[model samples]
Target: MATQHDERAAPVPCALTPREERRSDLVDALRDSASVGLGAFPMGVAFGVLVVHSGLEWWWASTFSGVIFAGSLEFLFLGLVLAAAPLASIAVTAFAVNVRHVFYALSFPLHRVRGRLGKAYSTFALTDEAYAVTAGGAGRTFSSRRILGIQAFVHLYWAGGATAGALLGSALPAEVRGLEFAVTALFTVLAIDAVRAGRDVPTPVLALGCALAGRLALPGQMLPAALALFTACLLARYAWTRYTRTPYARTRRGGDHA
Candidate 1:
């Protein structure tokens, strides 16, 4: 009876220690970010190659990768740097190019992460790839450590790839044909991927429509104009959804109660 009572009282399930739990979370994060690293690393290498071919110092590849850390904007910055575009133009252009990040914040798992610094870094490091990967991990219930680990891993992949490519590019011929087209190709691929994700269709539609209108209306200022138009449309959509949905929901609830 004593032996049976002891057996029955013993825990049936084993629990992971804190260290083991952390290790498991980190492994999961790494696995989740694996695809992102693959995509980012190769493109980063291309960016570094382009930077070197553009006659900029090799260190600029790693520098921009670490500081600006924005893939598309970094590509655009190469041209802007070479052309010596005015600071104001650069600022406005960068904002227009990257304004879509504002939308990513709406659904990002930022609230799950702890610590002000961790949250801040996650926000700063939030790229399209990171957002996509994290969104997919919504089912996994990502922990703070996992989220930070994924971001850090992606950041390393980009920065390390750029540094490596810069070293390799320095040894290659300066007149590399078609290297400059990398940015265009990257954006095209990104757009296609966004469509395929099937998250929302109207955003891309609004972007295309606004871009076309901007091109026709403001030839030299298409980017800024299109961005402005796109932003306005998004705001309008938000307002319509918020204001229109709430009243309808309330009315339906009231009628049901009545």
Candidate 2:
């Protein structure tokens, strides 16, 4: 009985405890990631089927799942690989394809991440879904370990689902069409949640603007070029804030500096 009680009372197997603040953060992250992951998993299934059709072996698809990890890029590069495109061209294309991730990386709260492996895993698992999860997670403060858990769960879910899809691709052909919209719906809910949370509208609006601008201006290279544009816009916003400032408090509202 003592041993059983001790086991039940054992440490949480993580750096951060499930305190009030941390627990809330974890819940938020889970909610955020779950939404995004639902949408992305279908893409993984499609990729799994593509893996079989492209003459690549199981490990090929699984490796792409584990390493490359980005759904759109994986789809594109798989096509490129099948077409026998030059590696250099593919590398350039992949860089441009996944470049928005660099901005995401920059925005991620790296300070909360704890140890080396935790940080590395957080970096490695930095997918759109994972980012949504981490960003939406309810924590006011975080440790590296907590973030790693959030990230790792999403990453593993993605890869595991991909692998399962690839392996069972033949058995589940009927599940293809309708099931594929999960990832889209997931992120849609997250976007709505963000808006409903009423914490910040600028984030989604800025993202939307950048996306629209990139689609209009950059087209094929939207990811990289838009990221650049977004960075510039953020800098410009900062400059405006620092110099002219905005009306927030009564002092600023009265046309005086706060």
**Candidate 2 per-residue C-alpha lDDT over 140-248 given as tens digits, one digit per residue, 9 for 90 to 100:** 2555656776776677667777787788776675664677667667778777876777566676788789889998997988777777887888778765765675533
* Model 2 worst lDDT run, 10 consecutive residues: 1-10
List where candidate 2 sits over 4 angstroms from the true fold: 1-32, 136-140, 196-206, 246-258
Q: Which residue segments of model 1 deviate by more than 4 Å?
A: 1-13, 137-140, 172-258
lDDT of 1 by residue, 87-192 (tens): 9989998887887687777668898889999998999999877787776435238899999898888899898889888889967555445554544554566567
Give the total clashing residue pairs for model 2.
13
> lDDT winner among the candidates?
1
**Per-prediction backbone clash count:** 0, 13
Residue 31, candidate 1: Cα error in Å is 0.8
Question: All candidates: CA RMSD in angstroms?
Answer: 7.4, 5.8
**Which prediction has the highest TM-score against the true structure?**
2
Supply candidate 2's per-residue lDDT for 35. 57
